[model samples]
Target: MIGDPKTGTLQHARIEGVGHEGLSCSAVDGRPLEFALLDPTTGEIVEHGPHVAQEAFNVARQVYRNVMKGQGWLRVLSEPAPLTARKAA
Candidate 1:
């Protein structure tokens, strides 16, 4: 619900499987603990806890986007081109 409202509109990582095993916690504390979401394809992982799931998911999504962009799999139209300063006349 929080974070980028357009997050749903953006392209998300193709996660083959997510490991929620890390969510379990000891009976002593009885508090929900952070857990990891594992993306089987690019190995992109993120840890989320309690009410912060949306934020963590967004972060992991960005990481995946960056990896794809770096690998030339996707291009950002808003990416700024290199700048070159002009010589003084």
Candidate 2:
């Protein structure tokens, strides 16, 4: 489970892939998780993941939580920036 920094909301997600460069995931709610995906190599949250079944996301989140505990890193999620329209300067 990841917590949204903006609203303090939590969501479930599954780690689809992990590597030094970055990590990929899918959300369990059939709607993308609002937290940034973490890059283990840099130890930073950088991107978001796709949507998946709620049940799957929940299970994946639990597994992720356990893995995180072993890594000795804070289990917090970063919020992604909101997109906005740009005006010609």
Candidate 3:
């Protein structure tokens, strides 16, 4: 999960819902793609949008962490290696 800190969280725009058969609804919180970040293995969207689901925030944190470490955009499904390597025995 090597990626830049900026935007590493894979933040997403608000998801507004349609109400009353065409009325406007408030935008959902927590972004949409964040949910996928919870599970690094599958990286599936446990739920449709990140806000409704709790996983999005988790992914966002990962993105932020990696980006801070001078990494590039990384997918939740991707593997995250250690920042430093140890000498081989």
lDDT of 1 by residue, 1-89 (tens): 44554422314222222444212322234433344556789778643454344444545555668876787443233222355432332
Candidate 3 off by > 4 Å:
1-52, 78-89
Worst 10 residues of 3 by lDDT: 18-27
Candidate 2 on 20-80: residue-level lDDT in tens?
Answer: 2233445775643344547889978654434323333554565667686796443444333
Error of 3 at 3 (Å): 17
Model 1 stretches astray by more than 4 angstroms? 1-51, 71-89
Ranking by TM-score: 3, 1, 2
RMSD per candidate (Å) reads 15.5, 14.0, 13.9
Which regions in candidate 2 have their CA more than 4 angstroms from the true location?
1-52, 71-89
Q: Weakest 10 consecutive residues, lDDT, candidate 2?
A: 15-24
Residue-wise lDDT of candidate 3 within 1-89, one digit each (tens)? Answer: 34643432323354332322221222246432322223567776444443333344455566767877878866554333455642332
- The model with the greater lDDT, 1 or 2, is 2
Overall lDDT per candidate, in order of appearance: 0.43, 0.48, 0.43
The CA lDDT at 77 in model 3 is 46
Error of 3 at 26 (Å): 6.7
